[model samples]
Target chain A: MKRLVILAVLIVFCSSMAYGDAYRVSMRWSAKPGYLRLVLESGEEIIKTARVYHSYSLVKVEFQSEFSFDYENTPDAVDISHKGSSLFININGLKDVKVFRLADPSRLVIDAEIEKTANAKTVPEEPVKPYGLSDVVMVIDPGHGGYSMGLVGSDYKEKDIVLSIARSLRYTAGQAGAKVFLTRSTDKYVSIDERINSTYKKKPDVFISLHMSSSPDFVVYYAKMDTSIRSKDRYMLKYSQLGHLGDSVKLSRVMAEVLREKFKRKVRIISMPLPLLSSIGSAAITIELPDGKYFDYNASNRYALVNTILKGIGKYER
Target chain B: MKDNRYLTALISILFILVLAGGYIYLIRMHPPEIAMENKTEPSSQPVTKPGSEEHISIKLFFPEGHKLVMEEREIPRVFSQKKILREVIREFLKGPAGTGPFIMPEGVILLSVYIGSDGVAYIDLSEDLRRNFHGDAIDEYLLLKGIYESTISNIKINDVKILIDDKEVDTIGGHFYANRPLKQLVTQEIKFD
Candidate 1:
């Protein structure tokens, strides 16, 4: 009778172990506000949460088994596909993936892996409701334009590079089904105050300022500036959703990690007080892409950057 | 047994009283009245004769380095100001060579400067300025050199030590370092940007 009972217990334990083969994904925490990131064992399929500022808004979801999938953000849903053993994602119609590695508050890395016998089609696309009590809206600010070329490199101008990246971001964001607005689409000058005022009118869920570095060196740089303009009224309106201005630090880290992996370049993220990065009422981050001066901004680099960013948006889409 | 307990209690009380008496005696012997009075009073003024100590003012210049330091001294300022210090810094943003429209980008740079007691000037920023600055090395060199050079020249000091911000920086976006300090070449050459 004792032997039979032991055998029965062993069989139950074995079956439970066999049934539960899920990979554990872990994330490092920082004081900044943004989506929580989790890295899978495969280093290819990263899971991200919707935009969140308050700690109470964080949510964790576990998968039964690991699978390979590349994601692109669209208005209705995220387009996800798997490339055999690897994950290759396409955004809107753009191809290629770029990853950015950033370190400031801390390093947050997103990696994915493929599960055997699981096809890309098996993974379902789920719709996300807007963040907060109201609808989700995002403001995209392109850095430098018109007469202000910002940083001038030998081959490209900072204004042009940021504008292109911003346009791509806007397209992907719109496809993700969020209301997106751009401070300027053409090569025209918009005063710093005007940009701030426009963002205030929309009362966005997040603000992303796009810029490029002018360092003759090919290093990835990230900056967040502290602004003196303390709008008590604005703070009261968005404080619960946006947390504080310091959330930019978290947003920069997440975006930098994605950008670095996509471009395969030495990425460095910095924190500073600047008008554009500091003016947003919600979570804001400024991304400065390599200006192809010290480094070659070849086709691979562009595709990698675009694909990675789109995937990140899809993962973080609300 | 009751008689023994009473005797023990009496002895303990006597010991306590003796200790208290000793403590009070020590306290009375070292009273702080005199010391406290002295501390509360102020001292009288000092009288000095004319020409007992000589005061001198000196200026140091770095025309190319674009920095200046002014020192005023009684007699003992010589040894404190004459030590050798090394610094690695990027070139300033504006200078004679950088007067044109272009800019340079490159690596870490070294600069060594010296200071003297009398503050006379002799400075050197030549090829060393361009040594580590890349691409537009000339432009970077000119900017750094112009700032330091102009500052030293305007000051009347004969000797100066020009060190960049304490330690070595990788590359301020792609400039270079010379790694050595030069003597003051001229005083009038320093120009302010």
Candidate 2:
């Protein structure tokens, strides 16, 4: 019986020797403006090198040194597991994942761009946003009018196409519970000054301008400072869009994502000094649709376009 | 005695060759001053014109289909950078003599050109410059690009800050940001063989 006990103790010692004491790592999480940040930290060893592999919803990190981490505080939308020598982080819903290493103390940072709607879904009955339609106001501008005939397409003029889209956005957005206004609802020339006046008076939460162009399928733009202005006028002009630049950038991202999905095309966002948008004191973006003559302007396409804009606004609000 | 004579002949021949080589090298390096003074090439599309100490080359750009085509011209060196700038604008305002639309509107006039100590050229234009403007984004971009490209083509000037009727407006048109100078535009495109 003594020999039997000795043999069991020897087996236990051999197994413990085979697997060295595991490194204790800590995992932390926080929600940023547009993404959820996950941080894994190891104090004793610097993670000098790591292989990161990500697909649709999973981010896997294989470390040079195997470590065990407590995933107690993992968000409802995410699952964390450690197996073998790899750490697997499963993000529930997202547009993208970025994994990078930070030093000073060893750490791996994971940023998952979660869809706003998906975020709300994860938290049941917890109202995450005060962004109902009635709380949010929007202004839509249709480029050109009457004497100023926008570029002509196969069956429609640019002015005509923009007016139709602007009108559709107003109705669709209104039905969605947002107070929406249009710079010009009819086929009339609304001067840039007039549009600026409309934005100034409306003081909306978001302002969207619609147009069409060739070559590029679709483009979204927010305000960029025009460094050309000088003196007292410079102060006023610079400040006009300064306060809303961040809002515009965030809004543009949501808009671009939704528009990209709807059109199944690359949606580019740029920051340029657009006189019309720059001079207006509002969070604004201009979306230029495809102006190709062969492009279809059917009713279903229009419906999708309107829904796309509304979806973008809804996501941004959330 | 024969060896001495052979050495002298070889030395004389070597000296003459060295003199001839130096003469040819100098002739290539410095053309006759008269010829250098007289040499001037009319700038055309895609061709850059070079100038000497006595003159400055004006490189102008004009809108074609989508992009601006560059044209270089030479003018006698002036006393002030502002004067040289005016000449450049004047050449641009004259329009492309060949074909296509004028990059600048017909009635638009340059009210003044002011060069700041920091090397930014503040170009003031008449209200007609803004009032007479009509086109889309491409037209607006090309118009500003031409003016900015031509002004910076001259040396000593760094950037271009555009003004309307002596005051800074948001932009010439509602498309691009104007109140700032076109400092970011390329001054030269160095092509290698």
Q: What TM-score does chain B get in every candidate? A: 0.25, 0.64
lDDT of 1 by residue, A118-233 (tens): 11121112332222212347787876554445555454555555555566556545655667788876555566656777888988866777655544322222223223326664
Mind giving the per-residue lDDT tens digits that candidate 1 earns over B24-128?
A: 988787544323322321221111224543322222222232232222122221212211111111223221232433332333343334333334322333333
lDDT of 1 at A178: 62
Model 1: lDDT to the true structure: 0.41
DockQ value for model 1? 0.01
Per-residue lDDT tens digits for candidate 2, residues A249-292, read: 89888999998887888777766556677776767888877764
- Model 1 residue A14 distance off true place after TM-score fit, in angstroms: 92
Which sections of candidate 1 miss by over 4 Å? Answer: A1-136, A216-243, A295-300, A313-318, B1-93, B96-193
- Which lDDT values do the candidates have, in the order given? 0.41, 0.68
